[model samples]
Target: MTKKFYTVSARYWSTLDSVEIVQDGEKSAKFNASVITAPAEYSFHCQLVGTDDLYPAKLIPNDDEAEKWDVLISSFQIQGFNIENNQFSYASDCTSFFTPGIWMGLVTSIILLWILTYGIHMIMQLTTNSRFDDPKGPALSVPQTE
Candidate 1:
C-alpha cells in the first residue's frame, strides 16, 4: 500500500476573550494556527484543541514515520478572524489488504447471485419444457396438432 500525507490549516477568530467587545458588537481578534495529524500504527488517534482563535493548539508528528512536512495556509476569512503562517506535517501507511471477513462476504454474495439466476433458469426450463433461449436469437417453433 502507498501512504499519502496532507496538512490542514485555517485562520479564524474566537469570541471567548473580551466578552465586553462582543457585547458591543465588536469583531473578535484574528490569528493563524495549524495542526498536523497522522494515522497511528495499530491505533488511530487525532487530537484537536480549541483556543480563543486557533484550533488544535499544537501539532506533533508521529515518531514512527519520517519528518516530511506539508504546509497549508487558509486564505479565506471567517467572521472577524484572520489566519496566517501555518505549517503541517503527517504520514500514513499505504499498504494493507482488505480483511478476510469482508472478502468472504463479497464472494458469498456473488456466488448466491449466480446460484439464484441458475435456479431461475432451471425452473423456467422445467415448466416450459424448453431451454432458456436468448431473445436476440431465432425464435422457437410451436408444434401444431391435428
Candidate 2:
C-alpha cells in the first residue's frame, strides 16, 4: 500500500512550580520533595503536505495523570523523512536524567576543566624564583664575609 504523507507539529510550554497531588486535590508543595516544579501544556496540529511515503510517523498521547502534559516531539524522522502527524502507532513513557547532548556537554566540561587544571599545574611547577648556583666550581668569596 502506498503510504500517505502527512505533516504534524506540536508546540510545548512548561513552567516550574511547587505542586503536589494529595488525596483530596493538588496542593502547593515540592514536587517529589526535591524542588518546585511546574506544569506542562502542549498543543498539536496535523496537516497533509504532499504525497510521499519515505517513512510513517506516529504521535502517541501520554496517559500519565501525575504529569498531565502531552508528549511533545521535538523532532522525529524515519528513513530521512521528517515525521509530523497524529498517527498513533507507538508509545513511550519514561523519564530521563540526561540526553546525548547533556552527556556530551558534561564530558566536555570535565575535559576542559582537566586541561585547565593541568596547564596551571604545569606552569606552577615550571616556575623558578631563584637560579641554581654552580656546585662543581669553587664558590666565590664575598668582599666582606668569609
Best-fitting candidate, scored by TM-score: 2
Tens digits of per-residue lDDT, candidate 1, 38-73, equal 232221122333232243232233322212432222
Backbone clashes in model 2, listed as residue pairs = 7-84, 8-84, 8-85, 15-38, 16-38, 17-37, 17-38
- How many collisions per candidate? 4, 7
State candidate 2's TM-score: 0.27
- Candidate 1: what lDDT? 0.36
If scored against the real structure, what TM-score would every candidate get?
Answer: 0.26, 0.27
Segments of candidate 1 deviating more than 4 angstroms: 1-91, 94-97, 128-146
lDDT per residue (tens digit) for residues 7-69 in model 2? 432332222222333445652222321111111222222232111322122222222453443
Candidate 2 lDDT at 2 equals: 17
lDDT value, residue 25 of candidate 2: 68
